[model samples]
Target: MKELICISCPMGCHLQVEGESVENIVVSGNGCVRGIIYAKNEITAPKRMVCGTVKINGATQPVVSVKTKEPIPKEKIFDCLAELNNTTIEAPVSVGDVAIVNVCNTGVDVVVTKGLSKR
Candidate 1:
């Protein structure tokens, strides 16, 4: 058996996962449906949701926080971040504006977290 702390919810369930069969995997203290799914995946293949900054044009700040519209494969996160770091966008950026599209071929776009106004 392997122990895991569920990060999907604030409750952070203490769980035990083992074996390939779902019936053989013993889970305890999960707070919600999402936690169950999270724990199952975490045991098989852990993943993450990443958020970071990207350069913004004509804004008071040099950059803005951008995140994928949907979670991408964890392996591509660094490459996505690096790609975003290398790119810049014009100002008047909406809060949900797409800063980088099709990042790392994960079929996800990094979007602005907040509005960026023109100088």
Candidate 2:
């Protein structure tokens, strides 16, 4: 059995999961149905949203905030960050502009979260 805290909502239900796979697991201590799904996904292919800042040339700010357009595989978080760390973009970037396409081959783009104007 594995103990986990459900992050599906603000409730943060403590969960106890048993079994090796989603097909045969038993989950307890979830406060809502979303917790069940969260547990299942968490035990299987966990994913997370990646966010950080990247260097920007000619921008009023030296860096721009960025995030994954979608949740990426948890295992790829560091790889994604590495790619973003090495990335430098031009200024005049707007919020929602793609900074890196298919980042880490996860089929998720890294988008600008904060707009930056040319200096």
Candidate 3:
């Protein structure tokens, strides 16, 4: 059995999952159907949205904020960050622009969160 707090809603229902494997898992204490799905997926294959800053060249700011277009596999987060850390983009970037494509081969793009003009 495992205990988790539901993040699917603001209610934050405490959940308990019991099973030997993902297929046989049973979830309880969820107030909504969404919470049950969340718990199951979280336990079997957790994912997370990554947000961070990347260095910019000749930009007004030293770095620009960015985020993954979709949640990535939890384990690949650090690898994704490593790629971002080693990257540098030119100025005149706009919001929603792809900073990195198919990051970590997860088929997710890293996009700029804020526009940055040339210095």
Candidate 4:
């Protein structure tokens, strides 16, 4: 059996999953559509959120916040981080700039969340 927490809302729904085809799912705490999506993804192909700091050249803090626009394959999370950690970018970054493209080959890109200018 597999367990997953629904991040759809404040009421985190706990889902219990079983079976090979993932049809024998038993969920009791789902509160809405978002929860259903979470459960389905959890049983079949679980994904992970990527959010961390990327080094920023000439910055006061030397790092800028970044996150994947979409959930990436959980299995490739480590690989994604490996690439991200190895990357370095200059400041003057826009909020929607693609910080890391083709992350883990999961067709998801990590991007900067806030603009960072050289100071």
User: Tens digit of lDDT per residue, candidate 4, span 25-119?
Assistant: 66656677777677877778888888887888976668888998998888988888888898888888989799888887889988988898788
- Residues 1-119, model 1: lDDT tens digits: 77788887677788766665555666666667776787677766667777989888898899888888887777777898799889899888888988888888888778889897898
Report RMSD (Å) for each prediction in the order shown.
Answer: 1.8, 1.4, 1.6, 2.1
Candidate 3 ranges beyond 4 A from true positions: 20-22
Better of 1 and 2 by TM-score: 2
TM-score, cand. 2 vs. native: 0.90
* TM-scores for candidates 1 onward, in order: 0.88, 0.90, 0.89, 0.84
lDDT of 4 at 95: 93
Backbone clash count for every predicted candidate, in the order shown: 0, 0, 0, 0
Q: What lDDT tens digits, residue by residue, belong to model 3 across residues 4-117?
A: 998877999999988846689899999999887888888889888999999999998899999999989999999999999998999999999999999999999999999999
Where is model 1 more than 4 Å wrong at Cα? Answer: 21-25
Total residue pair clashes for candidate 1: 0
How do all the candidates rank in terms of lDDT, highest first? 3, 2, 4, 1
Clashes of 2: 0
Ranking by TM-score: 2, 3, 1, 4
Q: Number of clashing pairs, model 4?
A: 0
- CA shift at 48, candidate 4, in angstroms? 1.4
Candidate 2 worst ten-residue window by lDDT: 32-41
